[model samples]
Target: MKLARLGSPGQERPVVVLEDAVLDLSSLTPDIDGSFLAGGGIDAVRDAVASGSLPVLEGADSLRVGAPVARPSAVVCIGMNYAAHAAESGSLPPERPVIFFKPPNTVVGPDDAVTLPRGSTKTDWEVELGIVVGRRTSYLDGPEQAMEHVAGFVVADDLSERTFQLEISGGQWSKGKAAAGFTPTGPWLVTPDEVDHRALGLRSWVNGEPRQDSSSRDMVFDVETILWDLSQYMVLEPGDLVLTGTPEGVALSGRFRYLTDGDVVELEVDGLGRQRHAVHAYEAAAR
Candidate 1:
C-alpha cells in the first residue's frame, strides 16, 4: 500500500494513494506518525480501502505534499555501505556498518527547496534507500529476524557539505549532514510487502545530468543486516528512519562540480518514488 501526507508544511493530512486518486485517511487517523503505524494503521487502511469505505479527498492535488511520515524520533544513517561508494570515498568497506545521525529537524518534503549553507562550496548529494521501522526492536538474533520489524521504505537524499564533514568539525559527518532541509524524504511510504527491497534501481541527477547510477544489489551491508546490527546496540522504535547509504558517483569523489544556487536535483528508487529539489543559498533572516 502507498501512503502519503498532503497539505501545507505543518498542516498535512494523512492520505492513501490509489490508482489515480488520493483517499483521505483523516477519518481514521490524525497523522501518519509513529503511534499510527504502531497501532495497526496499515492493516486498518487496507481494510478500509478494500471495503470502499474511505472518502476520496477533494482538492488533494492542489495541496502541497509533505513528507509521507511525520517527524521520526531519529534519522539514523549508515556510511559507505556501498562497495563502489566506499572505494570512491578513498576507503575500504568495514566489517561492521558505520553509523551516523541526521537530526529529525533536517527532514523536509521531497519537493522542498534545499538551502545551501553559508560560505559552503562542496555541498554534495547522496541518493539512499531509507528504512522505516514499525515496531520496537532490540537485540535481534540475526538478519533473518529483521523483516518483521520493518514497516516500509522511502527515498532519501543525504545531502552533505564536504568542508564541514571532512576538513573541519573534527571529522564528524553529521556536522555537515544536519542542516535544515538537507534530508528530503518521500512522495510516499511504500509498505514492505509492495517492494522487493533487496533489489531496486536507484539513481540521481543534478540539473538533468546523471551523476549516480547504481542498484541496491551493490550494497555492502544489505537492509536486513543493517537492522540486525543496529538492533544489538540501540532500540529501533516505530517511525525511526535508517538511511542505507549511497552508491558510487557522488561529487565528493571529484567527478562532478558541487551544487550551486538554482540547481535542481532529481532522484528515484525503482518502486518507492521520485523526488526533485531546487537548491538555493541559505538566508540568515529565515532562521
Candidate 2:
C-alpha cells in the first residue's frame, strides 16, 4: 500500500493511495506520524480499505504532495555506501557506515522548490533510498530483526554544499546538508511487502539530462545491516528517517556542473516513486 499526505505545507492531510482511488486517512488518524505508525496504523488502514470504510478523495492529483510521513524527529544519513560514489568524491570505501545528519526540519515535500545555498559553487544532489523507522530501536540482537522495525520506504534526495561539507569547519558534513528543503522525500511510503528492496533501480536527472543511474543492489550496507548497525550506537525512534546513501554520478564528481539558480533535479527509486525539485538561488533575507 502507498501512503501520502496532501495539501499546503504544514496543513497536509494523510491519505492512502491505491491504483484507482485516494482514500481519506484523516478519519482514522490525524496524521501519518510516529504515533500512527507505532500504533498499528498500516494494519488499520489495510483493514479499513478491505471493509470499504475510507472515502475516496476528489482532485487529489491537483494537490501538492507532502512527504509521506510527518514530524520525523531524526534524519540520519549514510555517506559513501556506494563504492563508486566514494571513488568520485576522492575517498576509499569505508569499513563501516559513515553517518551524519540533517535537521528534521529540512525534510520537505517531494515536489517542493529547493534553494541553492548562497555564495555556493558546489551545491549537489544525491538520490537515496529512505527508510522510515516503525518503532524505538537500540542494539538489535541481529540484522534480521531490524527489518521488523522498518515502517516502509520513501524516495529521498540528499542535497549538499560541497564547500561546507569538505572544505570547512574540520569536515563536518551536516553543515552542507542541513539547508532548508535539502531533503525532498516521498510521493509514497511503500510498505515492505510491496518492495523487493534488495534490488531496485535508482536514477536521477538534472534538467532532464541523466546523472546517477544505479541500483540499491550496489549499496555496501543493505537496509537490514544499516539499521542494525545504527541501532548499536543510537536509538532510532519511531518516525525517524534514514537515508541509505546515493549512487555515483553526482555533480561533485566534476563530470557535471554544480547546481545553480533555476536548475531542476528529478529522482526516483523503483516502486517507491519519483520526485522533482525546481531550485532557486538562496536569498539572504529571512524567509
Candidate 3:
C-alpha cells in the first residue's frame, strides 16, 4: 500500500494515497511516533487498513502533511554506494560501505521549498532511495535477515552544500549533509510488497535537465547487505531511515554543475512516486 504524510510542514497528517485523493489516516489515531514503527505498528497499521475498520477520517483538508513517520531516531546515509557516482566524485570503489548521518530534523515533506542556506554557494542535489526500518535489529546475520526488518521505502532528495562539504572544514562530510532542510522525503512511503526495489530506476533532473540517472541495480552494496553491515555497529530501531545512496550524476560527480536560486529539482523512483523542490537564495535573519 502507498502511505504518505501530507499537508504543510508542521501540520502534516497521516494519509494513504488512493488513486486520486489522499486517504486521511490521522483520525484513526494520533500522529504515530517513531517508536510505533519500531515496535509492531507497521503490521498493526497494515492490518487495520486491510481490515477496513479504521475510523472515518474528518478534517482531511484541515491538517497538513508531515513527514510520514514523525522524527526518526536517525537518518543514516551510505555515500558513494553507487559506482558511477563514486567515479564522478573522483573516488575509487570502497572496500566497505561509506556511511554518514543526517540528523533527524532535516526531514521535510516531498514538495517543500529548499533553502540555499546562508553562505552556501554550492548547493547541490542527490536523489536517493530511503529505507525505513520497521523493527529493531542489531548484529544481523547478513542481507537476508536485514531485509526482513524494513518497513518501506521513500524517495529522498539529499540536498547538499558542497562548499561546506568539500572545503572549509576538515573533510567531515556530515557538516555539509546535516544542515536543516537538507532532506526532503516522501509523497508516500511504499510498502515492500508494493515496490520492486531491485528493478526501480532513480532519476533526477535539475531545472528540467537530467543530471543523475541509474537503477537500484547499480548499488555496490544492495539493500540487504547495507542493513546487515549497519546493524553490526548500532541498533537500527523502528522509523530510522537509511538513504541507500544516490546513483551517478550528482553535481559533485564532476561533469559538475551547481544549483542557483530559482532552479527546480525533480526526482523519482519507479513505483515510489516523485518529489519536486525549488531552490531559493538565502536571506540573513534580522538580529
- TM per prediction: 0.98, 0.98, 0.92
Candidates 1 and 2: which is better by lDDT? 2
Please list all clashing residue pairs in model 3, or write none if there are none: 6-64, 6-65, 7-64, 7-65, 11-64, 12-64, 12-65, 12-66, 13-64, 38-238
Tens digits of per-residue lDDT for model 3, 1-287: 77777666666667676564555566555555566666666677777777876654556555544567777889999998888888888888788998889999898877777878788878889999999898888998878897789889989988888888779658678888877879988877888998889878999998899987799999998999999999999998888889999888878866767888788999999988888888777762211
Displacement of the residue 67 alpha carbon in candidate 1, Å: 0.9
Native-to-model Cα distance after best TM-score fit, residue 286 in candidate 3, in Å: 7.8
Report how far residue 42 has shifted in candidate 3, in Å. Answer: 2.8
- Model 2's number of clashes is 0
Q: Rank the candidates by TM-score, best first.
A: 2, 1, 3
